[model samples]
Target: MMAPRNIAPIGYSGGSAPRSGPSGTLGADNRLTTYANTTRRRVDTILELFFADKARRADSDRLPPDIVGALHAHIFAGGSRTRATLCALGWQSNGGQERLPGAVLRAAASLELHHAGVVAYNDLIENQEPRRGIVPLRRMMEFRYVSESLGKQSAGLLGLLTLAWSDELFHGARLTARQRCAAIPVLAEMRADVIYGQLLALTGMDCDLGDVDLALRIVRYKTVGYRYEHPLQLGASLAGANPDIRRTLSAYARPLGEASQLCADLRSVFGNPLTREQPRPEDLQRSRTTVLFNIAAAVADADQRAELLTLTANPDLDATGAQRCREIIETTGAAAETVRMVAQRRALALQALEATPIPMPAAEMLRVLARRVTANIPSSCCLGRGTS
Candidate 1:
C-alpha cells in the first residue's frame, strides 16, 4: 500500500516556473512553491489521463463505475504532494536536469498512484476517521452501496484495485529499458517496506508506548523508508545518480521524516480539535506512545505515571481525564522536550544536506521541504497523517 496522505504528505502550494541550477539564484521560497504547485498539476494531469483511459476500457458492459469514481474523489481530494515533490527534486538533484522530462514526471506520478493505493488501504487499517483527515472514502462507498458493511468492503477492494493500477502506471511511465532496470528493484523494495511498516504499526498498537525506539522505528519504516528515502532514491536511481547522492538523500530523509511525525503528534494532542476534517485525537485515544509521552513517563513521579497509564488508551476518557494527561505532559516538560527534538532533527537534516556535495538548489529545495514539515504546529491541528 502507498499514500501521500498515509505518508507525511505536505500541505501548501503556489509558484511559477523558473529554471535554476544547484548554484542558481532563484529564491528558495519561490522555487519551492513553484515546485510544489508544478508537481501537483503534473500529477493531476497524469491521473486525468489515466481515468480517461479507464473510461475508454470500461464501457457499460465492463467495470462498475462507482468504485473508480470513489477513488477519483479520494485522490483528488488533495494532499501534501510530499512524495511526488521529493521525486522531482531527486531527479533534478546534482544538476541532473533543469526542465523535468515527461518520463520523470510520469515516474513521479507513479509514486502518487502507489501512495493512493497504500493510503486507501491504510484508511481501513487505521480505522480512524474522518478518513484521510478530509473526505471519508469508506463513508463515500457506504453512500454508494447504501450499506455500511458493503461500503467498507468496497473500500478494501478499491485499495487492491488501485494498487494494481499503480503498477500499471509505473510500467507505463515510459522509462527507458535502462531506467526501468535501475528503478524496478527500488520499486520492489518500496512495496515491501510499506507493508512491513504497516505490520509494525499494527503490532505496536497494544505494546508499550513508552519505548521511544520502537515508536521512532515505526515512523522510519512506515514513513521514512518509502515516503522519503525510497521516493528520493527511486527518482535518483531513475536519473542514474551515483550512490553518494543517494546516500545523502537517505541521511536527509530519516531524521526529517521522524520530525514530521513528531510535529503531527504535537498538533494532535495540543492543537485545536475543531479544524475542518479533523478526527478525534487518536494519539491519546490509541496510546501511540510518542516521544512526548515517553519523556513524561521517564520523568514523572509514580502518581503522574499512573495518571498517564489511565488517561491514554482509555476509550472512556472524558474531557477532564484528557486535560489531566495534558497537564502531566506540560508540567513534566515533555511537550517542551518534544519541541526541542523537532528542532534537533531539523538541524540534523539540514546538516546532512550541507555535509554532502549536493547542488545548492537541490539542497535548498529539500531544506524548504524540511522547514515546511517541521514548521511550528499552531493551536489548530491542521496537519494531516495524525500521530502514526
Candidate 2:
C-alpha cells in the first residue's frame, strides 16, 4: 500500500497557504459558508423558476398545485446541504476557477432534490410521521386518501415525481460532453445504490442480534455510497477530474461517510442540540435497526437482549419504553463502543485526507466537513435549526 502523504493539518494555525478561487485566504469555516450561501441562493432561484414555470401552465399540468407546494416546502425545510457542499468542494479539489461554474451549481442543487425524493419515500416505507418538524410529503398526501392502499400509491407517485424533477435539473445543467459522460453514469449508480441499500435495510428489519456485518453493509450502500461517495464523485467528474483524483476523494469519503452515519445514530439516541431535524427517540420509535442496536444486542446479557428485542418489537414504543431502551443500550456498553467506532473511523478518514493529492484548500475543506459531520452539537442549540 502507498504510504499516506504529509499534507498540512486542516485548519492549521501556522502560516496560511495562498487562497484559491473567490474564497481568498478565508479559513475553512468561512470558505464553506461562502460556498453554502452561494449554492443556497442558486438553489432557491432554481426552485422559484420551476414554480413560476409551473404556474404559467397550471391548468395544463397534470400534477396538483398542492403537491407542488408540498415539494417547495420540503425544499425550504431544514437541510445542511452537505452533499451539495461536498460537490462544490470536489470541484475545487480539481482547481475549479472563480465565480462558481453554473453547471456545477446546477448539478449540486440537483443532489438536494434527489435527497428530498429519497427521504420522502423512506419516510413512507418506515412509517415515519414528521420530517423537518412537519408532516412528511407522503403523510401529507396520505390524508387525502380514503384507504391506506390508495394513500400509499399516491404518495409513491409523488415520490417518483420528486425524483424525476431531480433528474430534470441534473440534465438541464450546461456541461461539456466529457463532463456529462463522466457524471451521468455516476448519478444513475447513486440512485440505484440507494434503492438497493434501502431494500437491504428493509430485508434486515428483523435482523438477528449482533448482526454487525449486515448493519455496516447497509451503511456502506445506503449512507456512504449515496450520501458521500457519489456526490463527491459527481462534483469531481463535473470538474473533469481524472480517475486517480476521484479515487483519492473516494478514499477520504468512505470512512467519513461511515463516521457520519455513526454520529447520526449516536445523536438519535443521545440527542444533539445542533441538529434541527428529527426528534430524539425517533429512531427507537421507528424501530430502525442500526449498528448501535446490533452492538448492544451483541454485548447485552441474555435477559438484557430479550428486553431490547421486546422494546424494539413494539410497534408503538411509548416515552417510558423509549427511556428504558436508551438505558439498556447505555448500560450494555454498546453506546460506548459506538463512540469508539466513530472516533476510529474519523481518524481513518483524516488519515486518508493526509494522503490525498487534491489541492491543499480542498483537502482542508474535506477535513472541516468531516469534523462538522461527526462533531456533537452543543445542547443549547435548537433541534430544528442547525446544519443537517
Candidate 3:
C-alpha cells in the first residue's frame, strides 16, 4: 500500500468570515470578491437569467407557471453555490484565462440547478419540515390538489423536473458537441455517486447510527465527490487542464471535501454563531444517524446511551432535550473526536494544496477556501478533546 504524503500544512490560517458577494450574500469563498475573474454573484446571476428565461418559455407553452415558480423559489432559497464556483475556479486556475466563455459559465450554472434538484429530493426523503419550519410548496399543492398524497407526489416530480432543467441548461450551453460529449462522463459519475451515497444513508436511517466508518462513506459520495471532485474535474476538463494538474487537484479535493462535510455536520449540531446555524432539533429528534451520533453511541456509557436513545427517539424532543443530547455528545468526546478528524483532513488538504503548481491567484484562492471549512468551528470544540 502506498503511504500517505507527509506534507506539513503551511500557508493555512483559519478562514475568516468571507465578505458578502455583490448582492450581499455569503458563500463558500472570499476570493470570489478579491479575484475579479469570477464571483458567486456572477454564477448566481447566470442561474437567475436562465431560470427567468425558462419561466417565460414555460408560460408560452401553456405549462404550469406555479411549478416553474416553485422550482425557482427552491433554487434561490439558500445555498453557498460551492459547486458552481468550484467549476469556475477550476477553469480559471487551469489557464481558461480571465474572460471565461459563456459556455463554461452556463455549464457551471447547471451544477447548481442539478444540486437544487437533488436537495429537493432529499427534503422529501428526510420528510422533515424545512428549517424555516413551513413548506409553501407542499402547502400550496395540498390546497390545490386536496390530497396530501398528490402534494407529495407533485413535490417529487418537481424535484425530478429540476434535474431535467439541469440537463436543459447543459444541453443549451453553446459548447461544441465534442466538448459536451467529453464532459458527460464526469456529470454522469457525479449523479450516480450522489444517488448511491444517498441511498446508503436512506437504508441506514433506522437509528442504528452504526459507526464513523459508515457515516464517512456516505460523506465521501454524498458530499465530497458530489460537491468537490466532480465539479472541479468538469471545470478543468473544460479548460483543457493536463493530467498532472488533475492528479494534484484530486489529491487536494478529497480531503478538502471530507473536512468540509465534517465541519458542516459539526456546525449543524453544535451551532455556528458565525453562520448563525443554531442546533437543529429535527436533526437530533429524527434519528439523523450521522457520524457524530455514531461516535457518541460507540463511546457512551450505559446511562448516557440510554438517555441518548430516549432523546433521539422522542417525537417531541424540545430544546431542553436537544441540549441534553449535546451534553451527551460532548461528554463522550464525539464532537472533539470529529473535530480532530476534521483538523487532520484539513491539514492534508492544505499540504497538498501548498505543493500544487497551479497559477498564483488560483492557488492562493484555494488556500483561502480550504481555511473557510473550519472557520465556524467553535473554540469550545477544541476543549472537548479527551473528556471521556
What RMSD, rounded to one decimal, does every model reach? Answer: 5.7, 8.6, 7.7
Candidate 3 C-alpha lDDT tens digits along 169-266: 98889987767876898899999999998888888776365377888888888878878888888888888888888777778889989888777777
Give Cα-based local distance difference scores for all models.
Answer: 0.73, 0.73, 0.74
Runs of candidate 2 exceeding 4 Å displacement: 1-26, 145-148, 273-282, 377-388
lDDT of 3: 0.74
C-alpha positional error of residue 360 in candidate 3 after TM-score superposition, expressed in Å: 1.2
Regions of model 1 farther than 4 Å from truth: 1-26, 131-133, 272-283, 287-289, 378-388
For candidate 1, write residues 179-215 as lDDT tens digits: 9999989889988888888888788776765677777
TM-score of each: 0.86, 0.86, 0.87
Residue pairs with clashing backbones, model 2? 80-388, 276-383, 276-384, 276-385
In Å, residue 252's CA in model 1 sits off its true spot by: 0.6
* Whole-model alpha-carbon lDDT for candidate 1: 0.73
* Backbone clashes, candidate 3: 0
Give the Cα error of residue 36 in candidate 2, in Å: 1.6
